[model samples]
Structures are given as structure tokens and as C-alpha cells.
Target: MTTEKCDITPNTIVGDLLRDYPELEDKLIEIAPVFNKLKNPVLRKTVAKVATLKQAAQIAGMPVAVLINKLREAVNMEQIQIEQDSEGKTIKPGWVDKGKIVIEYDASLDIENGLHPAAKVTKEITNLKEGEIYLLITPFLPAPLIKIVEEKGYKTYSEKLNENTWNTYIGKQ
Candidate 1:
């Protein structure tokens, strides 16, 4: 079956896209396997309804334009141009030094063991020295924590490693 070209803007909701272009799901997962989260019913009921292509790109640690273009290609649409949003810190945090403190909290493991690591992570970030950074390793984007920490005045740069892993660099500026 020919999948007709569809307009997939950065603001397009994931659920809407999936309903209109089902095949694009596979292409999206191909772009970033973490998109497999779309299969989870809990997230589908919540995240998919509001998760935009731009947010998905942030979660996948890819450029918004790159992700959008990939989906556009999969749907046979002409590529569209997108300028980077200045709202986020550098996506690639090259400033992360090996000397910096790392709080490797696998939230997925915590969920399995019925524990919460957010408090512990918050403590570590609070204890950081002026020049120190906090490298938080997690199973997912840790969106809530990101917002909370940022609201507390820390700068962050998040990177997605694969389907089940992410690293968020938090600098207490």
C-alpha cells in the first residue's frame, strides 16, 4: 500500500500521526528505537496524545528537523526546514568532565524494586560544588525531574544513548 505524503510538523501529536499514517510508526521506531514506548498502553493513553515531534526529538536526543525530515521521507512528503529552538541548552554536553560527579540512577530498576531515586538524585545535585556537574543516567528522559531541576535554576543537556538509556547533564550555574 502506498503511504501518501502527510504534513508532519514538529508540533504534530504522535497519536494523530500514528492514526493517520500507521506505517510511520515503524519508521519512527527505526529513527529512534526508544519510540517503542509507543507500544505501552499507559503511555499511549497519556503521552502519545500530547507528545509532539519536537518533544520526541528531545527525548531521542536528535535534532527536531532531522526527526521531522525522517518521518516526512517515510510518508513521501517533501522535506521541510526547521530552525533550532533556543529554549534548550546544548543537546551535546561536551562540557561534561570525567572529574564531575555522576548520579547513575536507573529509574527503571527503581520501579522494578519499588524504590524512588528522584530524592537521592536531587540531593546529589544540591550538593554539587560550584564547578561540578551532575551526570544523571536514567532509563528514560526523566522529564519531570528535568523540569523540577531546571525550575530550581540548573541548566541541563540531555542525550539519549539507545532504546532504554539516557544521560542528562545538570550544571548548577
Candidate 2:
């Protein structure tokens, strides 16, 4: 009887191996969580619909810092859309569409207050919109706000920031 050892080192190129041996693709997919931490966005995105930096790090079996650095590189390079408000006043952190609302995380606000002021501000912005996609940007926002936005049929997107604080955008042209 002969026994062949399988190479399962973290450094192994799982994607290349799977590509060469198509049959192993299923097995690779089965253990996707392990490969996700490999700092490969192509692999990570293919496996998970929504992968956070922490989750990616766990999948690649690497430090969070390394995964974050890689994610930053993977983000779309296209310039974000900017537009003016009804008054034509410059809106800082403005989006391309007024229908799209963004809520930034703010650590300075008191958590005991039930809801972060930024979240409230975001809610108000959402109210102003007749019908538009709402996107949220923050290192971390109060959970209650997330539910409120969802209940209103607004789309939410969480963005990972370089720092711990949150920033909000009113309107900008």
C-alpha cells in the first residue's frame, strides 16, 4: 500500500491547483473558508457574496492588517460621483445621486443615547428622497440605524475605513 500526502500549507496556490485539476474544484469550494483568508480578492469574492475584512482575514489564515491592505487595493479606482443639493450649495461627501444617502459612523457620539446622531441625520436625508438607493459608509454604526434603514426599503452598504472614526456627507457638487 502506498500513501500520498496532500499539500495543505497556507502558502499553497489552491486556485492554480484547482484550475489544473478541475475535479478538485468541488473540494476546494467545500473548504472555501480556509482559502478565503489567503488575501486573494478574486477567490474571496467568488466564494462569499458579502465578505468583511475580518472574515477575509479568517479565510486566508492571515493577520487582519494584511487582508485590509489587500482589500484596499481591490476597491474600484473610478472616481465617485459628486453632485450639488437643491440650493446648489457644495455638499461635502456628496454622492452622484441625491436619492442615494450615506450614513457615516461616528465614535464621538454617545452610544447610550440609543442612536448615533449621524444615523439620525442619515435617516432625515433618506426621508427627503422620493425614491433612491441608500448606502451607508462607516467603520461601525449603531445597529438600530441599520434596521431602520432596511425597514424603509433602502439599500445599505458598509464601507471599511482606514481609521476608527465615522464621516458623514450632506451634499456636494
Candidate 3:
């Protein structure tokens, strides 16, 4: 009888990978600077500040720990600021204050208008405040979204995904 070769291709579920190799789980999340080096002008200009090390890792396709360390280095070098509370207390880096201006959108509207929901929201938010701080909340925004936000007169601190939506913080610069 001829022997049959058993298929051993690893299943790629997130949970399965995490359980099988805990070390790699963290490493898989780090992003390479090369992603930033994309030749497309749109990709090159679409920048986002991740709220958590894990997020950065996911975006970078690297390990979470590595992303954390890298972010720490960036903060130390003053390339990014470690925000604090009004009382001069060091709050967690990812935390955003409540009641901060947030933009919400209807996905249906975007689909009808040929616009991404996040981009629509950013445009509306920017119109509301010309030179002020506003926290943006959405799922995953692209270059068009950022361009709209900037044109509306706000600068972004970072872009984040929360509960299947994309978000970013903006302020007047």
C-alpha cells in the first residue's frame, strides 16, 4: 500500500497561532518602516499614530513588545509626546478624555456618496472646529480621509480602530 502524506499546512487562525507559538504572536504584530516607504504618494502620506503598542504591532506586522519598546524610544527622543492629565498626572498614552468632540457617521451615507464613512466623518468634524482639539472615532481610515481632515483645518495626533471602527485625534495646529 502506498503511504499517503498527511496535510500539515498550519491553520492560520489568530487564536490557533497565538496558542501554538506565544512568542511569535507578539512578533507578528510589528510593522516595518518599509510600509512607510511605499512608493504610492497616498500610502506615503497616510500616517497614523497607534493608540496602543498592540495596535502599532498589528499595523506594523511585528511583535507587540517590540512595538512597545519602539514607541517608548520615540517618546524618549521627543519624536512623540507622552500625554498627561490636566493635573500633571501621567495618564496612559492611549487614553482620550471624555466629551472631546467626536465625529460619528452612517456607513450607508458613505456607500451612497462614494465616500468612506471615516472620511465623511473627518470632513464634518473639521468643519465644526477650525482650530481646536477634537478626538476622531472611526474604524480604518485611508489617505482620502486624512486629506479631508487636513483640509477641514485640523491636525491629527493618531489613528486608531475601536470595535470595528476607525478613529483619530485632531487639534488645531
**What CA RMSD would candidate 2 show?**
14.1
The regions of model 1 sitting more than 4 angstroms off are 1-41, 44-55, 58-62, 68-91, 102-108
Give one digit per residue, the lDDT tens place, for model 2 in 1-173.
75443232222234433433345434433434565243466643443323333333333444544433333333322232223345332233324454454433344545545555555545565554443333444444333354345455543433333455333233321
**Model 3: runs farther than 4 Å from truth?**
1-58, 61-96, 106-114, 130-136, 159-163
Q: How accurate locally, in lDDT, is each candidate?
A: 0.75, 0.39, 0.43
TM-score of every model versus the real structure: 0.55, 0.29, 0.37
For model 3, how big is the CA root-mean-square deviation? Answer: 14.5
lDDT of 3 by residue, 10-93 (tens): 112223333343444334333366343333444323442212233334445444444444434433422333344554223333
Instruction: State model 1's lDDT.
Output: 0.75
- Distance from true location, Cα of 99 in model 2, Å: 11
Rank by TM-score, highest first.
Answer: 1, 3, 2
Give the C-alpha lDDT of model 2.
Answer: 0.39
lDDT digits (tens) for residues 1-173 of candidate 1: 97663369977878878888888888899999989989889887767776667768878777888899888887778898786557432335556665775554556777558775668778778877776888877776666676568778887777777878777788876
How far does residue 49 in candidate 2 sit from its true spot (Å)?
20
Summing lDDT over every window of 10 consecutive residues in candidate 1, give the lowest-scoring window: 85-94
Error of model 3, residue 108, in angstroms: 7.8
